[model samples]
Target: MAKSAKTKTEVVAETPVPKKTRKKTEPVEDLTIAEAPIQLQAVENYSRFSEFDIYLFKSGKHFKLYEKLGSHVAEYKGVIGTYFAVWAPNAHYVSVIGNFNGWERGSHPLSSRWDGSGIWEGFVPNIGRGEVYKYFIKSMNNGLELEKSDPFALWCEVAPQTASVVWDTWYEWQDEGWMRNRRKHNSLTSPISVYEVHLASWMRDPDNPERFLNYREIADSLVPYVKEMGFTHVELMPIMEAPYPPSWGYQITGYFSCASRMGNPQDLMYLIERLHLEDIGVYMDWVPSHFPGDAHGLYNFDGTHLYEHADPRKGYHPDWKSYIFNYGRNEVRSFLVSNAVFWMDRYHTDGLRVDAVASMLYLDYSRKHGEWIPNEFGGRENLEAISLMKEMNEAVFKDFPDAQTIAEESTAFPGVSRPTYLGGLGFGMKWMMGWMNDTLKYFEKDPMFRRWHQDQITFSLVYAFSENFMLPLSHDEVVYGKGSLIGKMPGDEWQRFANLRLLFTYMYTHPGTKLLFMGGEFAQAREWNFQQSLDWHLLNQAPHKGIQECVKALNSALRNQPALHDYNFSPEGFEWIDSQDRDNCIVAYSRKGLNPSDTIVVVLNMTPVPQQGYRIGVPSVGIWEEVFNSDNPSFYGSGVSNTQVIETQPEKWHNQPQSVVLTLPPLAGIILKKSAK
Candidate 1:
């Protein structure tokens, strides 16, 4: 219920707080009004925007809109009040509404900027931190009235309560060391073992299964576990505020606000700060492709489809039943780009993994013929989206040189991870979806049939270095009736775990960065359910413990072994030693670094039968020892390993000058490193 009557605007001025007493997080509501009050119109004498800001915002170059557009707590003319700004050009009238004003629409109307930027702004006294509010907009078109959440809100009320909150980003960050030297950790050449997690489901209140652990609680548990597990970075699933938990944070309503269900903005910052302190980088999953069509969200914003396209073909997403963004619009581009930059700028995120990129790149993605409109050039490419992506990437890298942008692009779009100056999309990395699909397909088959389909495993190297790639066994593979990674294997319990270990070893040794979904590391038996926590009880079993230990070892090897990561994205870093061993259901390769002494050989045995005295080619004539064997007893593997270091012979095997004879364990992968000459 709201008051329908319009009221004349008014503002009250009071003595300013001492500069020394002012703090960003100080609640403005605590201030006492002066006895002799000075009253003025609510929309008069206060503005946070400058002429240049309007110019940039109009021309779509304003990437830091978070500073200009959101509701910011400020002291105006010696009085503490909140400054509100929103872009709703189609609205004839816009007013602030919330509990503070008794949901009165016309009591606090904002004035349009004189610069024709379509930005409505004003200052309201006594509206301070923690006040819930929404824009009550009367659209010029058909006098349509809408109550919409602020797109640039720094915080929002929890789900089932959609009003935006007046808040500030103030946190004492203790991650200076991490921020100063993050380049090395987030470098393309570094060993980036990302553990992708859905925060709500990663772990919950053990005492109450229905409750989600807040950001601080998650930090206490997740930080140490990831540190001990040896992952270099943590890629959190979309954390933006979404009304429905089933959407899993993807259907973002508050683009700039962290999900209120988790905690406030500072709470999330604390979690990220703790991670950085632990030397772990954070990657946020960003979704600029489509948004859920909620009434209070961007859809039909201002009752004019302001944030989305006017046409159904270009504006709607068929697959996800969401509304696509109007990338062609300048203001929308500025809003989207600003949202991307805000995370890195304010949240100190190390990277952005752009989600559903392929869906954004093509004009007819998931649509049949005649259902999509071609670009002006009569091409199927989404030219506007392409341009927006380039601008977004340029802004992200230009502002934060150490940060990276990774694309979850499935199609063969050229130069997705290349530089924008070279007609590329300018991402630092792209997920290798082909590799994940092929590897999983090969592993799910009976070992006897794998030899016939050797190309399924070897096909990835054909384009491994085409663009910077990250092999991802993500959560998508284990949801919606899809079985768990372990359950995907075709074998008894022991063999299934063995296959998962071998799969992980292959991924780490492969020529790319690595990403593993939460439950995959330990082989959680059931499919992922966003509603419940992972089966932590599964760790009590020996096999599950074995898989977890195997992943830890793989991460260690990926980090410590230079040969595995130094040239991971370069052809010079890899060589095929025995790809034609289809008869033996085995594939072997060598990894090289700057120094020849840093070379390592990897061999994978796909079958259950051990190969006694298997001869694999070596790059150098020296003593080579089994540095890591997946079949070790520690990982619950059948105890089979080459305990002795062997000197290579001038055997001219597999086109190499020298070779070594070693015992290959059944259904396992092993790493060999040459000893110092």
Candidate 2:
């Protein structure tokens, strides 16, 4: 009875043997379908996909296609083997080609389903997981033949080798406590300070810089470091398989495959599990906007623009030199949405930060006049893409209610973060690109001229509450000739470090969740390089070390202080105490929690000149103490600070009931909390 083949429940409920501990899996020895004891079956009686599955896939509602469309190891009758299925509607003939058959085409072919769903599926006996394979497809339209990787593969060969590996998403997860209570951690009002990391370059082996750290190795170091840094979450730059390293994982070739450069599917799961065990959430960047035109990728599958649009004006991305998905197509939408859900379901990712959302929403993104086509409504909006996003977000929230879907949208599209029922796009949060741009531009200018640019810094507050926002100082700011965050500061070394510290202080106290790129926390002095590790040696220097300490303190405050997070998405959480002090290059604001007693005041001195006895408004009549100061000597700032608690007098200032006189340090930020009597 073929050793009493394992049931589907048994296969998935238990962990797959790890690569290191399992017996070596090699190409089938001198085996071909014609010479084997068992033959391929046109699986109908033992088919994994049913009629309803095909209907759902054709109608673009099959969000769980991974369970049916991919190569799954199973037993047919009493023989153990693997079942393979793929979607190539334009293909006249399709066959499985791999090392098992000496890479010979037509040795074993798949059968097209009778349902007219354009799906090809079959079960080949005597073969199981760990087999490397690709599909040999002959186009029905042009007779064009090509080999393509599986779109629903769970794992692919490490980049530089374009072949899919038969694998399973089985792992013994130990994050029950985290899974049960992640709703509060991922809530809109919770503290969500994300540390964006590019896995390849974040750290590399010291002895062999060329070798990438496997997922388990990364978990050993990343979990402890993030826990110590006090970041609530770690946002990984896309870990999906992409051939070109320079694309930084945005150019995905395998939608459902884990980047084999790191490790197998289980290895990546272990990394996420480690983070969740430490109470830290994981957010993966998902790219549905476009894909690279690699030979084996989704560009021209089945010798037709089946995955992308037929028209170059609608299909191609000029800026990125890639192909945009045909979001209007039902099957293509099913594929994209299924990929999004696959990660969250199989990998236990806490959220998906959808990338290049602005490009997806606009038909004329980066195109000149006469180079683009308008939507049916004669507008620039890509209605099809918008609908796909709404559907994707709805499916994600429906299945995983505690999970979040963030958007990296740059344009001022109305309600990018609002719910779909309210005529919005239905994302959990949108990147505050305007705030990131204006804040950087204002900080780049000399503090002497910041008075004239006061409006630039405060303008974000005007539309702050329009959507649930996440203030991002992301990887985009430190790459492609844009200098490092600290390098953008305009001053001597001492003043530059102070400005960086001040930037973090103001960002934490701002009215939004925060996201900072990897190296920015310690003030790396150079632009980001994907090929190498961060400048970790900079920590030995006092100024760089101080910047790290300041960021750690800021993250601690963001996580522990309810006033900083409770109303981050609402106007009730933030109130301007004194924004009209631009002459002194000063601004003060109050952040409040649900309870009025948890109010905290923030003040910033943009210039490198101290002001003693600077009066600021207070919301309560009590002694207010300095809770945090960026000017502390430990952060490499001038030691000017308010050393004692100051009693608020019964004076009306800045529309507040009480006021207090305080010392303002040069080029620094300070937080004041009223003490309980």
Candidate 3:
């Protein structure tokens, strides 16, 4: 029940009209009176402007205003002493409590004066750097007591008892044009395979479980492995400072600081610098959707709801049990936008993979059936959050055009990776979740059931064309009860090993850029556990050693093949040749470049039965040589199939000009390159 009314304004002034007499009507033109300056009529106070109109104004005028405000804020940069501000509409008094005051509450009360609005401002003189503090607010309405930290704190440090640390220091980046060069060389699918690894669990010295390798140790050891593996990028899973152990770095406590537990800030920068020097791109997992629940963290900072919404319904996430940010607020938006810029500008990181974007896009995202409310228009979308995300993307692209921002959204939200100008979420790329799920489901089925599921592999192309996608074997699918990729096979040990080889070969040959999680290449025997180290000894074992060799070979082949890299970004790059026989477990596909001369055909057999003289169609009529084979004796395979050097017959099968005959073996894959056209 909202009320609406309009009020009319009276004329304030009248202009004197001059009386004119026209003799004989010289060119008698009818003069119409101009509308009276569209009189200052008041519309209903309850009525608000349209969201698009507001956005237009904000994007133009408000941004200019913020630029002016930023200039004002910049004037105090590096000037010592403490300048503090708080927003507590419901609180009467707010005091600064911290180590600076010997942890006393009343010793150094923040002298805050309320503007007519809820905001309270104060400045504490000579409160130098590295001081930890929280706010003590007295609730006016309920007389409740509350303690909070600064929501916009650039740095916070409290020992073992407190979770955050002060990390406000300057970084000097020497790689001035490295980002530009990287973007120019790398595309959505330019052989840009990524090795996704969690730094803490990736390596642990046998002598120390509590004491893991620092950033320097990781860079020295892991970078060589990544370089040898031939992955273009290294995606770290949430390097931001967090509190919980075994939490996979998702519950971030410090938004602007690197995880201090790993190493010092300089060490993290050194890692990034080393990676850049090695010509490997680094992508950070950025989680701006939510913050941790720790009292010392972002929650209730500044003795009020500064970062998050004041309303619990809007602030709390149901499933994760975390606090969501109020993106509707301008300061919050600026903070996040600046954070993104800070990482790229300071660290020289090439890209970001934004985590849990679906959680940020909807109001009722993870809520139970009856616990959520819709907008006034009866839609469940959180338009304000969407707008903020869009603005953030726009800001990132404008500031750092070379840096990519990838989305980790699982929902079927259209255009999550589309350009912002196209009325979509502006992500450079998005995880191909549907393709991964469908492919995994197809792979998990028995050979007999695979015929019906074969379409799953081919049919994904329909939606895959919509956005740039990464074929990710992310950390999510490997850890916990989900089991490792090798553990998901449907056969004996040898068959399982062969199935994994087939899977990897297919993955390497797939159109999208691939991401293989740590220990996946070596075929770790058990599922991944965050608490324990990856089975490093597996590299010594013969079976696992063979898998690693195959991985290396596959990575090498992917890098060398022109067809694989040239047109790998487009729908036309991939063509399914055969999926007809499920019992025999044979699937064949081909990749072709924009130049017809560059072409490659791959055939895989997952069945126990070996067949001689198997004919598979090729995309070109030319001599086809075996470029790679997963069943080679060096890879610990049975080597039942002949190492055939076949020539394609002059035939146009399935619109292609070639067909090659080869011997096919159980649990093997063969990659063939057409002879030079």
Residue lDDT tens for model 1, 42-121: 43357767788888888889999998897987777677889899998887777887777767666678876666688888
Q: lDDT for model 1, on a 0 to 1 scale?
A: 0.89
Residue pairs clashing, model 1: 10-42
TM-scores for every candidate against the unseen true structure: 0.94, 0.94, 0.83
Candidate number that wins on lDDT, 1 or 3: 1
Cα displacement (angstroms), candidate 3, residue 254, comes to 1.4
TM-score of 1: 0.94
Where does model 2 exceed 4 Å of error? 1-44
Candidate 1's error at 522, in angstroms?
Answer: 0.5
Better candidate by lDDT, 2 or 3: 2
Predicted candidate 2 versus true structure: per-residue lDDT over 1-677, tens digit per residue: 11212232133224221111112336422234213133234443556777788889889999999888879877778787888898888887777877677666656677766667777776777776678888888787898878899988988887677888887887889999999999999999899999999999999998999988989999999899999999999999999999999999999999898888988888899999999999999999999999999998898998999899989999999989999999999989999999999999989999999999999999999999999999999999999999999999999999999999999999999999999999999999999999999999999999999999999999999999999999999999999899899999999999999999999998999999999999999999999999999999999999999999899999988987789999989999999998888799999999999888889999999999999988888998989989899988998878899987789989899999999999999999999988877
Q: Rate the local accuracy (lDDT) of all candidates.
A: 0.89, 0.89, 0.69
The stretch of ten residues in a row with the least summed lDDT in candidate 1 is: 12-21
Residue 257 CA displacement from its true place in model 1, Å: 0.5
Candidate 3 TM-score to native: 0.83
> Residue 158 CA error for candidate 3 (Å)?
7.4
For every candidate in turn, the CA RMSD to the true structure comes to 6.3, 6.9, 16.2
